[model samples]
Target: MDLGIAGLRVVVTAGASGIGLEIARAFAKEGARVVVCDVDAPALDALDSGLAGHVCDVSDRAAVDRFMHAALADLGGLDVLVNNAGIAGPTGRVDQIAPEDWDRTLAVDITGHFNVTRLAVPALKASANPSIIGLSSAAGRFGFPLRSPYAASKWAVVGFIKSLAMELGEFGIRANAILPGAVDGPRIRSVFEHKARERNQSVEEVQAQVLATTSLKRLIPPQHLATVAVFLASPLGASISGQAISVDGDTQMLV
Candidate 1:
């Protein structure tokens, strides 16, 4: 099916690696001009030659605004914004987490979404069809041990998109959230190792325990999440707004 994203200008945050990189590649495949910004300059340069990239730290407001302007200027205008940059901060009990860790995680995960959306709102509104897709997680839908900060930040992302849907709807702008389950990626592996060490268990043991809770009994790939993202940005998804859809392989039932 033609997603109708051809020639459209799309911006994806944290597009250096993992799901972000896959999403950028998928957008390029759909014939949309993709602008990917990440702090990892080397990684960004390594992406497919067609991708337009910039060195950006989403947590920094000034840098984010500059990147947004550059993306808009380069793309000539913006039609879609993917607020995908986020961090799963130091994993630990709520009381064990440092103040700085909490602040830093929240800054990048939640506030960064706000920063990019705020700068791109006018451009999105000006487009004939505009959309915003936020990358939340299964943790956003449910509580878990040793992931307090991550859960909090992801939950806030959901709130941000829902509120934006209400405010942007009248202007023909759509906002939605994609919540993925335990995706198999470097970041998640790192988190698993951290959890194993923290909990005095083997890495395999912890991983097995986590997978057992999911209905799919396996990890999700970045491409799996990217496909949904592409759809949300496409003209076919114009009627989808304020919805929190999952790519979790049916991990948990939602109301």
Candidate 2:
């Protein structure tokens, strides 16, 4: 089905790899002019999307401002903003986590979204159909053991989007968050390994236990999120806002 977002200008953070990259590609496929930013300069340069890429650290307000200028200049305006840049953060007990680690995690996972969305607001207001899609996680809904920093940050993202929906709705802009659970990728493998070590279980066992929480008992792919991103930015999602949609095969909880 045509999403009716062709020619729209979209910006995706950390779009050089993983879920972010897939979201950018999905927008490009939908005929939207896409711009992506990542701190990984080499990865940004190597991206095959043929769209504009910038080296940006979303946690840095100045860097985000610069990126917004460049991206807005390239696209003339913005229709969609995908705040997808995030870190897995330290996986350990809260008491074991360093103060710096907690601060850094919150900066990237939560503050980064604020930086980008603040800069993108003006351009978004000018669009006929503006949308802001944020990346949260299933951990945002349920607490995760040994993942306090990550969980806290992801939960903050949900709050941010909810507030943004109310603030931007007056301007005809929509805001929502996507909560993914145990996505299939290197990142999740790393997470599973950490959980295994922490729980004294095998990686396979830890992964199975995590999957068992979901009705599908499967790991979701980055593309699953990409599809949702596309749908949320399209006309079909015209009235959808302030919703925290989970793409985790119907996650029941986190164990």
Candidate 3:
């Protein structure tokens, strides 16, 4: 399927590596004119020549402002905004987690979405087929233990998208969130490692316990999320909005 997104203007946050990188690559593969922003300067420098990149920390409003200006200039305009930046946050019980950690998690995970979306909205409104895709998580839909900050931030993403869908519907802008499960990556591995040490268990045991919650008993591929994001932003998904679509492997819960 063509997905019919050739020449589409797109901006992806934190697109220098991991899931964000995969989504950026996917859009580029589909022939979209893409620009990505990340805090990692080296990763930005390493991005494919076909895709433009800038350094920006989404949690900082001023930084996001600068990034959006540069990205919009590169793309000439925008049709899609992929808010894929987030952090794992500190893993611990609610009372045990530091206040700073909690604040920082919400700052990057949820506030960052607002920082970018607010700037991208004007450009998106001008497009013929504008769409906003937010990267939530399975934790957004479930009560995750020892991961309260991350869970709370993701849940906010769903609420944010849902409200955007309603508010932007008249402008023909579609807003939706993609909830991913334990994705296969170094980030997840680090998360597992942290959890294991926190619980005094082996990494393998923690990993197995997490996978056991999913009917498929597997971690999600970043490419799978990229594909769904592309489809959602394409003309094929014109009628889809205000939905939190899960790309998890039939995940029953977050362990």
Candidate 4:
């Protein structure tokens, strides 16, 4: 099927590894000109051929503008912006969370979304088909006790997308969010590691507990999420606007 995304100029933040890298790969495979940005220089260096990337700290607004402008210039024009850069801040109850951790989480997971989108909106408006894709989490739709900060950051992303969708719809642009659960990765393992240490359980125990909630009983592949993202950016997904779709394996039973 023609996704109508071939030859489109696209930017994917945090495309060095994990889900972000998978998203970038999907677009590259579909023949789109992909520009990736990430803090991991080594990962950027290891990207597949034809994929251009730059070292960028999404937390830094100045670096974001410079990277986006350079990449856009190289790609000729930008039509899709994937705000996939994020961090899982320290796990703790609201009362136990430190102010510093909260601020850092908000900066990258939330403000980083704003920084890139704020810079990319102009180019998006100019495109015939413009789309903004955010990688939110199932936590974005609900609250979990030990993840107040991370939950807040993801929730903020949903609000950001909804408001931006309304404001940019006049300019023929669409915004959407993907909420995934337990995507198999080392980063996810770290999330459980922290939890295990905090709650006095082995990492195996935490992983088992979380996996039990998923009806599918397996880890979600980044490729699955990447496929969905590609569809959203294509003409096939023109009507999928301002919606947060869950990519979880029934891990989150959203209302």
The top-ranked prediction according to TM-score is 3
lDDT of 3: 0.95
Arrange candidates, best TM-score first: 3, 2, 1, 4
Query: Taking the tens digit of each residue's C-alpha lDDT, what string does model 1 give over 59-147?
Result: 99999979998999999889999999998787778999999999999999999999999999999888987999999988788886777
With a 3 Å backbone cut-off (N, CA, C), the pairs that clash in candidate 4 are none
Please report the candidate that would top lDDT against the real structure: 3
Name the lDDT of candidate 4: 0.90
Would you estimate the TM-scores of all the predictions? 0.96, 0.97, 0.98, 0.96
Which tens-of-lDDT digit does each residue in 193-232 have in candidate 3? 9889978999999999999999998889899999999999
Give Cα distance to truth, residue 167, candidate 4, Å.
0.7
lDDT of each: 0.90, 0.93, 0.95, 0.90
Candidate 1 TM-score to native: 0.96
Off by over 4 Å in 4: 253-255
Q: Considering lDDT, which of the candidate structures 3 and 4 is the better prediction for this target?
A: 3
Ranking by lDDT: 3, 2, 4, 1
lDDT of 4 at 48: 87
Q: Which residue pairs collide, candidate 2?
A: none
Worst 10 residues of 4 by lDDT: 246-255
Alpha-carbon deviation at 229 in model 1, angstroms? 0.7
Question: 11-32, model 4: which lDDT tens digit per residue?
Answer: 9999989999999999998989
Model 1 lDDT-worst window of ten: 246-255
lDDT of 2: 0.93
Model 3, residue 229: C-alpha shift (Å): 0.3
